[model samples]
Target: MDGYRGFLGLLVSALLVGFLSVLFTLIWVLHYREGLGWDGSALEFNWHPVLVVTGLVFIQGIAIIVYRLPWTWKCSKLLMKCIHAGLNAVAAILAVISLVAVFDFHNARSIPNMYSLHSWIGLTVVILYILQLLLGFFAFLVPLAPLSLRAFLMPLHIYSGLLIFGIVIASALTGVTEKLFFALTKPAYSTFPPEGVFTNTLGLLILVFGALIFWIVTRPQWKRPKEPNSVLLQPNGGTPEGVEGSMAINFGKADSESNNEAAARKRNLPLDEAGQRSTL
Candidate 1:
């Protein structure tokens, strides 16, 4: 279908670049720096980069585009929302732990916290991310908020999510550069040392990954079709049987119905059946 054109290719490319960025991050910490650890040392600080890239950069990116998956269109929007929120929650947890590692490392060494420009931006982004998560859960996931509120907040929620993801990439880039400058004294960063070159490449990979995610989520045609009460989703989401039976009837007539008839039926249906007729 025209809606799905280039979706698979773009999705695959995003996945490949995302994983590669994660792998390069591991290599930087393990091979180039002092490997991972939990103690309040530079080793513990290594977890900061690893977790940020894995959680904030990679997993959060996946969450942003989860709604765009074509296969999941047959599933309930509620279930998809849960999956999306779950991914964001995990990313948030990792980001918090990464912050703890930084604070611990600094405290142990008597270094000041939130001193650098990168630290200021990173902390602000993390706080904004938590706020976004909480507001989204209440407005969209729970039934407490009215439709008008959800509609009003939807654009803000989307824009803030992408903005946070962009800031995360910026934070990662600046954080790495600051680390190189501090760590590379004998072979200064300006000398284009091996560590500087490698980290610069890592920064480029992160930029590419962020760009792909933004492109995937922003495209209008790639948005998932809305079929909230469809029978196809009931098997996985436990939708009410009555709702399933009614949706089944509509799917049964989909093949025989003319385009106008289908559109009329969709409008008249209780669940707002906006998915493709051929899919039904």
Candidate 2:
């Protein structure tokens, strides 16, 4: 409660703005500049920015933060995991289709591929995003790795995800600007035409959304509180014997729990001399 007061509301508004802004930009592209479809025409290229912004950047943001939502607190950890994995999977599929759209458009027009900064960054982000999703699925979803392995990787995964998200948003912003210039050059983009203003505003909104997401996910105080008394239920409709602590966190280092009292003193979290987590 101490840490959640102001930030959650900020997250909700940020999410809405980010999502709507992306949707607006996609519509703007399809409606005014290039109508969306996959007929291997210039119009087909429009689908790339739309899907990458919506799926890779916007939808992916929600997937990463689903666990932080207040409504998810009472839900089982397994349920949240499923939601996370499923959202990410859908985002990845959309990203793939968007990439295909662009490549097809380029090939049809004899345009060389990966020439711009935006393309390079977008491709890199997608590759890394796919890798991250695969690793996360095996590590956290199935519990295939040792607790220590998951522990070491968890921080990396979170940090890399945030980084990838930022890069993707940045790339999308540049892409939007580029599209505005090339597609609306009848009056010139430097004159601050309506298209320019609208696209730039959409890009700025995406930036704001990315900032809020990073804040919500990385702020130490925003971390979900442990449910100390939650029982670990097994698949056989029975509680795991002698297992009576929060399974809220996945893949905590078992060896470290043995030392929570002695050496597990982390900022914003404390452990008693008995190795039990302190409520404070």
Candidate-wise lDDT, in order: 0.88, 0.79
Lowest-sum lDDT 10-residue window in model 2? 237-246
Model 2 ranges off by over 4 Å: 3-5, 229-280
lDDT of 1 by residue, 1-116 (tens): 35465888888989998998899999999999979998898999999999999999999999999998988878777899999999999999999999999999999999999889
What C-alpha lDDT, on a 0 to 100 scale, does residue 14 get in candidate 2? Answer: 75
What's the CA error at residue 24 for candidate 1, in Å?
Answer: 0.8
Clash number for candidate 1: 0
Give the best candidate by TM-score.
Answer: 1
RMSD of each: 12.6, 13.2
Model 2 Cα RMSD, 1 decimal: 13.2
Q: Write the per-residue lDDT of candidate 2 for residues 16-114, one digit (tens) a residue.
A: 987787778677877676577779997788888778878988889888788778777777777888999999999999999999999999999998999
> What's model 2's lDDT at 221?
70
